[model samples]
Structure formats: structure tokens, C-alpha cells
Target: MSKKDSAKATLNDLNGKEWVKATKSWFVVNPKPRSAGQANHPAKYPEELVSRFLRFFTKADAWVLDPFAGVGSTLVAAKELGRNAIGVELNGEYVEIGSRHLEKTKGSGRTYLIMGNAHGTLEHLGEIFKDSIPPFSLLMTSPPYWNMLRKSRGGNDSVQKEREASGFDTYYSDSEEDIGNLDDYAEYIDTIGEIFDRLEPILAKNAYLVIVVQNMRDIDGEMKPIAWDLARRLSKTYALRQEMIWCQDNKRLGCWGYPTTYVSNVHHHHCLILQKR
Candidate 1:
């Protein structure tokens, strides 16, 4: 389809992301999924989603970075789309998994996979990315959703400490670099905002920073309206562009009728697409 037609089609879907433009053999899928749930980084994300963001938000040969590179979905998609990609992942095992895949499939585009604490990236990122550094045109990352999606029955206190623990050797050996273990709601926003704050210098002047987060059900099964809170918090730095809805194909089944206060099974997630101004 033509560029104009493609944009129109993309806007038609009310999902978290949409397909934008295509170049060669591949048709890019936008706004990569949150996590692929691999054994290492059980939540790496889908490549199709990453490709779409690269296609529309950036030009060919542009630079992209995934702060919590999880399992390399972002780098894989960026390389495929003819863009340079750098992934900063905390867990060493995941870095191995993602880097190995990147080396095997690398073509004209290059990828740099770093296994370390991403919070301190500013100190040495330039040296490591000096030869490879380009003004990051796009940043598509999904921070840890406060670890609220856990199946355990522990209180919020326990979840925070456990979330930061490295999941490299265990069954759920996943890392939480995107959003570290901040217990309080206020702390969660502050911690994540600080991470984004560090990335400001590396991003291009007008780069787009897109964040994907789903609201969580509290211990009492109440929906915590985090999207609005996050938007308000981030508005201090980034300009809130558009709040897109990512409707999940699968939502929890069953509901109890409350005559006084009631809502429905929340099927959609909030994709807060913000730009650094």
C-alpha cells in the first residue's frame, strides 16, 4: 500500500500500536509487545511491535535504544528495518541470548548489546557507543509494570524486593531494569522518571519516547489508574503526544455485579507516547 493509505490504515486500529510504512521485503509492525516471556527475560517483547515503531518514528539508518533490552526483540527489529540498535540489559544471561541472535542475523545494520546496570549508562554510554552513537530517534521500551501482574499472594512490600532480584538462574529468572524495585507508588514514578531523565542527553532533540504500561489490580482487586498518574508525572519533561489504547485479545473472564460501585473487565492497556521537547 502507498504511504498515505498505510497511515490511514494504521490509524484505523484502536490498538496499542499500528503498522505504518514499509520499505523492502518486510512490512514493519509498530510498538513492539511488552515482553515475549522467554525463560531468561520472560518478558522481552515481540519483534513485530518493535519494527512498527522503527518504521514510522524513524528514518532508515537512524539509531534506536531499548533500555531494558530484555531478550533483544528491539535490536532484532531495528536491524531488520535497516537501523542501528543498542540494547542495555541488566541480566547477563539475557544479554548472551540476545547478542547471539543479533550476531547471527546482523546485516547492513549493526547492534550493540550491553550487559550492565542501565541506570549508570550516562557515565560510559558515550564511550561504548562513541563509534556507534547516533542521535537516538526512537525509544520504545516497556518498564516493569510495578510487578503487579505477579500471581503470588504477597503484599506490595514483598513484591518490590523480589522484583529487583535477578532471575538469571531460577525458573522466572527475569530482570527488572526498566523499572526497579520501588515500593511506593510515588517512588515507582520517580524511579522510572529518573531513568528517562538520564536518557535525555542521548536522545535526539525531537526524539520520541514511547512507554507501554497496563494498569494493575491491587490486592483488593481494585484497578489502579496508573496511566493518568504516569502521564501527569512525565508531562514535567516529555510532551504527552497521544494516549493510545492497546486492547488485549485476552482479558480475565467472570465478573461480580456491584450495585453501588461497578466497572467492567478492563480489556485495554494504555500506551503513553511522549516526545522529548
Candidate 2:
């Protein structure tokens, strides 16, 4: 074999073709049907999404962190991929469900799903992890989109109505600790930045963070550029690397505004990629 082919991959286990394919700026992934426990969470990103990044950013047996791990998607993905994972969730119910999933996960590495606020968990990492915390090579999470879930779109919002009818949570918990519950957009952005800032000590140098977020239209009909805003905010701390667009072609088109306005049915999210500087 040539010297280039014989060389081992340092970033991940992928070969040349796989690595090149993953570098595409945009991709589509129609989520698989969620398990019952997974469906209960309003805003849970798919494990496939997590696995894709995991395969690209880290090699086997690396440590991964998810500050807003809803129902342990990140943990389960990490376990399956042979990576130890630590997830911090604020809701006890979610923690319980996530723990059950983690217990059944058959894999080489360990998984820890802690029930606490993200900031608090970081602050007390030593006590929480029994003083043996691992430096995370990847921090992938889908935080609340600035309380957008809490905003009611009135009678025309069919998705929210269906969630209500099915006894699923329409929004994250009403906990004051959840930054998603904050009313002010500016404050919410700052809190999100602070959480990532707090992760600096534990994140390995050049560790990658994949934050999934979306731009949304507010109730007042103003555009809230959440994805861009967060990128700008966090770039001051972490090195802003690149963004991959996650598109969904399976969602039904909603006629949000009839004849007068041009409200779009958004079916995409921004996966902001950042590196620990």
C-alpha cells in the first residue's frame, strides 16, 4: 500500500470516500419512526443525526457530551458507536426514560445520563461523575429554539394541536432552570452562549460541537434568525467552523398564511459546527 493509504485516520475511523461524502454542505435525513418513549419529547433530534457527526468527528472510544440530551438519543448513539457518553437533562421524567434506554443499550462503552440543569451539571462535574470525568471530544446537542415551542400559533397550527390531542408534550418543561423557558430572546441567546462557554474546561482542545437549531418566524410575524444569531454569539468563544444544513422533505406543507402573507413552512435546521479554540 502507498504511504497515504497506509496512514491511519486521526479524526475518525472513516476512509477517504466516507470522509469526503460527509463533507457535503447540505443533506437530508427523514427521521425514522420514534419509539414510544422518544416520541414523548417535543424536540428530540434523531440518533442517526448524532451518529453521523460522531462518525465524522471522533474515533472509537472517545468521550461525548450532550448538555440537552432529550431521552438519551446522544447516549444511545454513542453507546452503539463505542463511545462513552455523558448527558445532562433537566427533566426527571426524561432522565428516567433515557436511563431505561441506556440500560438496555448493548455496547462497549459506558453511558451516564444525569438529571440536572446543564450549567449546574457542568459546575458540579466532579461530584456528579465521582471525580473521574472524561474530557469530551464531541459535544452535540439540540437546545430549545428560544422558547419557540411555548409560543402558541393559535387554531391553525395543526402540529401543536395533534401533539396536544395525543398527550405528547408540546414544549419543554416549565422549569425556570430551562433557558428555553426564558421570555427574552437576547437573554436566551446569552444563556445558551454561557452554557457552551462553561464546557470549555472539559472539552478537549479542538473538540467539535454540533448544535442543531433553526430560524423561525415569531408570533409578531418578525423573523428570528436563531441559527445565525447563535453562530455569531458563540464564535467569540469557540472557533466557528462551518454549518451543514439538515433538510426534511417528509414534512407536510402548512398554509400558514392564506392569500395575504408569505409565511413558509420551514422544514430545515442549521447544524452549526464549532471547534474548541
lDDT of 2 by residue, 22-112 (tens): 9999999888898788788888887888889999998899999999988999999999999999899999999998899888888887888
For each candidate, what TM-score against the reference?
Answer: 0.72, 0.95
Error of 2 at 38 (Å): 1.4
The candidate that wins on lDDT is: 2
Clashes of 1: 13
Cα RMSD to the true fold for all candidates: 7.7, 2.3
Q: Let me know the TM-score candidate 1 reaches against the reference structure.
A: 0.72
* Overall lDDT per candidate, in order of appearance: 0.67, 0.89
Candidate 1 lDDT tens digits, 1-277: 9998886444222234333222122222234334333444544456776665676677777788778777788888888878888877777778888877787675577788887666776655777856556788888877767755453433334332354464432222344543544457788877777778888878987788767677776667766667777888888889988766655444333343446545455555666788989
Worst 10 residues of 1 by lDDT: 20-29
What C-alpha lDDT, on a 0 to 100 scale, does residue 164 get in candidate 2? 89
